[model samples]
Target chain A: DQQVKQNSPSLSVQEGRISILNCDYTNSMFDYFLWYKKYPAEGPTFLISISSIKDKNEDGRFTVFLNKSAKHLSLHIVPSQPGDSAVYFCAARAGNNDMRFGAGTRLTVKP
Target chain B: DTAVSQTPKYLVTQMGNDKSIKCEQNLGHDTMYWYKQDSKKFLKIMFSYNNKELIINETVPNRFSPKSPDKAHLNLHINSLELGDSAVYFCASSQGFGEVNYGYTFGSGTRLTVV
Candidate 1:
């Protein structure tokens, strides 16, 4: 069964606008959440990660928010650029166990 | 030089054939991983090795096996390839094993097609 889920398959936004990608998980044991970005024909790369202990983590223009009570997490990119367009995957892990990834959401930042 | 690299960017083989995908990392990381992205586009971990030692093995068929000849190389071998096995396989490495890993550096995936 899939523990991590990304309900939206795609998202589109204009340049300099905010892009929000959401994800949810069913397993409450997951203590670490991460976001990954992928270009076509390339493997996914680590973007940002947030520990369950903290509700939010920010790195530059990318920010990840976690809501433990609702078992939800979201990635927000401020002033989205066309170069930021790519597939984003949400992943969660419970301690040393295997990390589980969502179905991924393709983000399109139009110029 | 590439930090992590996988061979055979694309492979098309007939069903029931055997194949292997080789991976190497020069980042001096101790842990290597094999992840498969299926038709549904979900990245699932198949195996993880730390310093050539098996650390995690998920629920996978016996036909699929991972071999680590050294700290920087992890190879995946499959027997009797099936149509269901067609997917993109990625090789990744991290600094830590088990729970201490910070993030992962992935290689360009190998897209396999079983006819």
Candidate 2:
């Protein structure tokens, strides 16, 4: 069974616009959530993370919001640039070091 | 310099052969892990080691073994490789053996193809 899921397989947004990616998880025990951006032929690089204690976390142009009751999270990027185009993965970790990752959403920032 | 590095970016071999994938982390972390991404792009943990001791061992085949020569290195060796084993293997590291704090750093991944 998939613990984490990204319903959208792909998304497209115009440059300078806002891009939103959504993810959901079935495991309520997950207390830590992370978002990673990956380019082709490269490993995923950490973008931002949110602790279950807080509802939202923002860094620069990126913001991550978590809704524990809904078991959902979203990543928002304002003024999306072409450089932001890549595959984004949502991951959740429980008490132990065990982590589960989503299938990933491919983002296309058109210039 | 790369914090996490894996050798043999691509591996191609016939079925029933044996091969090894080497991983190294220079971040001075005490924990290392191995994850596999299959054709469907699903990433799953295979094994993890802390201070050269096995901490987490997922339900993997017996043919697969993870060896940690030291805290900084974790290598995966596959015996009698099967076609189902074809996937992208990534090596990662973290400071502690818990889910909170000390985020994981992943390597570029080694793509293994079994023909």
**Which numbered prediction scores highest in DockQ against the true structure?**
2
Return the number of clashes found in candidate 2: 0
What TM value does chain A in model 1 reach? Answer: 0.98
In angstroms, the error of model 1 at B4 is: 0.8
Give candidate 2's error at residue B64 in angstroms.
0.8
**Model 2: colliding residue pairs:** none
lDDT of 2 by residue, B1-109 (tens): 9999999999999999999999999999998999999988988999989899998899999999999999999999999999999999999998886534546899999
Model 1 lDDT, residue B72, Cα: 95
Name the best candidate (by TM-score).
2
Q: Which ten residues in a row have the lowest lDDT in candidate 1 chain A?
A: A91-100
Off by over 4 Å in 1: B98-101
TM-score of chain A of 2: 0.98
Off by over 4 Å in 2: B98-102
How big is the RMSD of model 1? 1.2
In model 1, how large is the Cα lDDT of residue A27?
A: 96
Give TM-score values for chain A, per-prediction.
Answer: 0.98, 0.98
